[model samples]
Target chain A: MSTNGFGNISIMTRSMAWLIVCFLVLPITIVFAVSVTDKHYLSLPEQGISFQYYEKLFTSGPWMTSILQSFVIACASTVAAVLLGTLCAIGCWRLGNRASDFVRMLMLVPIMVPTIVYALGIYQFWIDLRLLDSYTGLIIAHIVTGLPYVVITVSTALAGFDPRLEQASLSLGASIGQTLRLVIIPNIKPGVISGAIFAFIHSWDELVLALFIAGRAVFTLPRRMWDGINESLDPTMAAVAAVLIAITVSLLCTDAYTRSRRA
Target chain B: MAGLEISNVTKKYANFRAVDDVSISIKRGEFLTLLGPSGSGKTTLLMMIAGFVQADRGDLTLNGQTITHLPPEARNLGMVFQGYALFPHLSVFDNVAFPLKVRKQSREEIATKVRAALDLVQLTALADRLPRQLSGGQQQRVALARALVFQPHLLLLDEPLSALDKKLRAELQDELKRLHRKVGLGFIYVTHDQEEALSMSDRIAVMRSGKIVEHGTPTDLYERPNTAFVADFIGKSNFVSGSVVEHRDGGFVFSGGGVRFVQRTKGPAPAIGAGVSIALRPEKIGVLRSGETAENELAGTLTEWNYLGSEFRLVVDAGPFGSFSVSVPTWQSDLAPEIGAAMKLGWSAAAGMVVAQD
Candidate 1:
């Protein structure tokens, strides 16, 4: 085939890819541009650059505390979800029975059911258990919501894994636990890490669950951002949003890097 | 050097018997192949020997010690799976060192053994490369080195060369045979390829439907299959169903479909009226000139001809006896047999053997 004969389809596909890329990136680019503006009341960049909004955000007390609380909650919840969800997915894969399939569907229910329903029900359950407004309660709620990400990613990784590796390891003087640690975990490390990262982001950015479950004592970043936006339109709020967007971009970039590495 | 003995081992998954009362013994340092087609229970039998699958009815012993209840790790057996199964994340050195590490060998001992194993497979230069970076043949050698590094009591190869191309498969077969001789460990190989079994094994257990129908040396199984299934499966054969005409010295004469055949067989050769089956291998039947004579001669016409590089396969239509194939060496043949040409086919009485049809 001649290069000229590659035809209009090749050019069309190239332009279409760029169009999709722009579609996904335009909002974030706009938010970045607005963040650096001197007047940041949700307007375009028509003024000089300034760092006063970022300074304002740093001086804010509740926002800083909420950021720390979000980090703590996300970290704790991701650890719990990845641990429990990976084990559950492994069990389901090995068993391949009706009961385990039902359990797998149950694990996926959080992803399917509306968050509002889960929040309302979980709020009532926590109140009955006297766990409402507690950090433990919030962590447990995030874990429940974040576990499906761990399950899906781990299951995707396990699809390429040969069950015979487990057999081969066991046959070669390794115990079941040793096989899980040495063979299974090493092979699925990328998937498990990606799942944990996604779960952490899910918990960190979650607003409705935090709103329904947490109180004044256990406010998170998203909850505080929701309150800040509702109360007043300030440049500090835009600065905080921009920082959250940066964290999300960093996490997504990390996920993409890990995915490419796995490939 | 542990010899394995399996006694009346039966594996029942629900109602279907995957390995039914199958018993075989592997002597120390012997290379035995479980040869069969797909779903013939060869792999299941190997898995049972490796302790991956438990036998429901019988016991297994290695070096006279009961290992039926032992886990695979405790059995101290090495295995090479169908698709190499080398860890993609690990380098070749680490993969071969894995078994030794699992055995809790010292770091220095592991290095020495891994190098020795890699050198044995001629893969020392590729030790630092990951498995995915190597070709199919190299990956297979890595798997072999990994399986052997720990010096296990027995080695199980489950169709180890099945994943490679034909040329590479043949190359690896020679390497595997050499490795077997060097290691001098008991090897239980499983493969569906009959030629692989014939070329590499000390003895072969021919399996069909979870049963060991025949077990013998490669020559014995090829030359003296006891059943029609075994005779047909091991090589190409022309089966002539007949009724016994007479019992003679160490043999019998049978007549089938208006054609007579003499068979060398054991026992009373069935009663005079009993039905029988005679199996004749294609290469055993010689193509002859017009005036040739033998203990059995048939008049036929060449119905089909195929040139197989070194040999000519001719399907001859013998009247009332159906089509019989004769394989003649191409080098020895003066002229190619033309299609529809009348030809004479002959075979000695010993070439055809009576086998049980079932």
Candidate 2:
């Protein structure tokens, strides 16, 4: 009845919060229900449930191949993006003035622009370089888009780091390389892991860039799902979405476990 | 043989000089402290010795070898930073063993040395605990163990105990003194705390504005400070500026505050009417009896008084000479001090030292 107490939830506010949670979670739950439906068509089950779509997804030729292809592409892009972005972040942190600010802003350009506009220009350049529909082409495109996540996460980690640790290591008869490996890296490992996880997720779920850059040979999971939805409405697409969600949840769990241990 | 000599060291920033042609040295087993206030070049000189900041101009030699340009790792100096700088991710044992591990020591050697070092700090019980798991004092011990485990040529400490509480700081100060005596290695310590500097160091170098203003044994500096800055910085002092009255006797006479002061000077005698400043320690000034007189005496009122547990600090307002503080022992006092009580203060000529104004 009154607003005097701090954080006291009114019935209206409590219901509104639950409403937003359901609004976000209901669609994913429906897809999960449809993935295990006994029916072949894309519909949530009323009574009976079976994992026929998942069984088909594991055994089918195109589905398994697309999953494997996406896995390799996502891992490769994440590795490249995390390594490059971490180095860039360190260099920027070391430079630490107006110039590094300009460089950091430039690195964020890939996230600022709409992907659709740049997708057209990139596809044209890829055709000239004969890299269209290739794993390298798709992975490179994914890395560019994922770099900002890695850089932001790693930079935040570095920001919290104490530079005096590096100095102490140096004073204790450790060289520059030893200081970085022993003192600096261990202190910032949480940031690096989260950055890698974010970059991997960014690449794994990316669609527009993959849709334009990839074709038959390098069909990522997202690309195949896009094509499947356009051509046919099977319950297997729901199975694919469930698998993607499972992987994302696992990555997030890994991040949370590491951060909690750090604390 | 492993003594260090700093010859005319200098460091400059963009436009300002941080250390200006300062030179000091210590023997192999001496505990030398560079004491100063903030921005007084004490830490800057320590960093140069540790090779974190190179001296723009000067030569630093250890034993007989020049180490002016050596990198920090190659300099073989141990430093205890103010915040301890213990590795948060490493256990206490691992943190202490880091220097040995980097030096390519065998497993048995590292384990034995780390155990001994941890035992020295009395933290062997917490060897397996991470640095973050320990209290502030425990972490400081781990840092000391880490710095000492390597047996570097000399140890450099930059206000290492400044972060701890007063009780913990006193505890660690005792621990550090014991370690110094047991290990017998040269120590170059930097601190703005004059009390710590006086209590810990075998020799103290007082710094001011990028220079070593004075260097001597603590007692020597306390008794015979060369300048007003050193006198005021080292401890509390009552400064009285006066013109020399007469050089009739070997002792000099100066008249100020309507009080004639017979002063002692170790240097050459000043001419008559020449200006001089005298530093009188608070405890040295005394409460004269009704008829008794000393070499120097003044009459004033006890305007205010603070009753410290062990001593009473009395502020006497002497007209024309301004106010000066006098500390009297509580147990030996015969008179209970009351506010606005008229009193006579007196001290021997030897109690006041002639100091330069600058």
Candidate 3:
């Protein structure tokens, strides 16, 4: 190819890349921009920034408690999902039979089944267990919703590991338990970390399951946000949303950075 | 007493019998190689011995103790996989120390043994490096050091050198033999490379279709193969199909394609008019000049020639016998052979033997 042709191709590629970046980033940028508006109502860029709405959030609203509750719920639900999902993935990978396949599909039921249907069933089930409106019920619901992410991420990670490493460890006089702990878990570290991140984000941002299960005692961030937008038109909701976006962005950036380091 | 004894070992998966009834005894401190192509049950037999796979109708004994029902960990055997299987997250020192640490050795003991094992493989300086930090050959040495560090009673290697380049493979082949001697441990090495088996093994068991077709020392199998399969697999062999004509001088005279060839044998000579096959190694045949005399000579024309550095491999179109090959030492050649050049090929009767067709 000629130099002029190469130059033209390079310019075209650079513009195309920028187009894609803008397409993906524009909505999130707009969300952040709108969340910090000085106006009392949601709108475009404003003349100044103010902490009045944030102060109102702390003094008059239950937003702080809901944020703390969301953090607790996300942490508990993520831990539960990661433990169950890792074991399930390992079992399916080893057994590789119809029964394991059935288990895998069952675990993925929450993903394939519509959230409304799941919410209705879980709502009734929680009432029977006397867990409705309780933190335990909220945690269980989020765990069920987050389980599939853990399974998929861990399964993908385990796919790259050679089974011979396990065999080699066993042959070297390590028992099955030692082999799993020393060899299998170390090799699948990335997958487990990625899965934990996904599960955390899933639980943190989940709304429908919480709406069905958490009534009075358990008010998570998303639930409070839902009520806030419905009840009022204030700049404080924007500040809370801005904070949520920042947390989510930081978590996603950490995931991407760790994945790149592993690569 | 044998170091390891496998009696009538058989393995079946569904309808496919991966390892048919096979028995072999390996001696202590001897390097025995299971030589065969893929799906030939060599690896399956090794896995059975290593206690990774169960045998359907066999008992594996080590030092007169039956271990057919034992698990891999209980068997206390060292195994090197095809991929080396070095722990990527662990440093070379920790990798070699793992087996020892699993046995709950003291930290000072582990450190000493790990250093000594690394020195054996000449990887002492790389102890702190992770597996990925090392090159392929270095990773292979680390694997070997790990497998041998614990001084397990037996060692099993599954195509350990197959992952390396051809030249590196040859280099490691020598190191493996040297390690085998230094360690004085019974080693069951699995490979498909005929040259590796011939050079490193005290004995080789050649397998086909999940069965051992022949087993013997390198020279015994090469010069005196019991079957044509062994003859062809162990080395290059040109088979001549023919019928036995007469019994002569404790041997048999075979007539085929308008030529008569005599084969010396200690087994029952083939009946007259019975079909027979003769196995002739390419290197055993000599390209003869005019008036050159030998035990047997046949006239032929050179069809193609390949220069293999040390030797010239010529394909001669011998009538009736079809195209036969003769390897000529390049250093001894007075003149290079041209394509279509008429030549004479000769070999002693003892060089070509009557081998079983199967």
Q: Considering only N, C-alpha and C atoms within 3 Å, which residue pairs clash in candidate 1? A: none
DockQ each = 0.76, 0.82, 0.78
> What is candidate 1's CA lDDT for residue A38?
78
**lDDT, residue B300, model 1:** 89
Ranking by TM-score: 2, 1, 3
User: Deviation in angstroms for A115 in model 3?
Assistant: 1.0
Chain A alone, model 2, TM-score? Answer: 0.93
Instruction: Write model 2 residue lDDT over B200-316, tens digit each, in one string.
Output: 999999998899999999998898999998898898899988889888555799887566788876667788989989998999999887898887888889899999988999999
Candidate 1: global Cα-lDDT?
Answer: 0.88
Off by over 4 Å in 2: A1-7
For candidate 3, write residues B1-358 as lDDT tens digits.
Answer: 6589889999999999999999999888988999999999999999999888999998999988999999999998899999999888899999999999889999999999999999999999988999999988999899999999998888899999988898998899899989999999999999999999999999999999999999999999999998999998998898887899999887888888888887877778889999999899998889877778777678888999999999999999988788998898889887578999999888887878778887
The segments of candidate 1 whose C-alpha lies over 4 angstroms from its true place after superposition are A1-30, A33-47, B266-268, B331-336
By summed lDDT, the worst window of 10 consecutive residues in model 1 chain A runs over A1-10
Report the C-alpha displacement of residue A236, candidate 1, in angstroms.
1.0
Q: Candidates' TM-scores?
A: 0.93, 0.95, 0.93
Local distance difference test values of all predictions, in order: 0.88, 0.90, 0.88
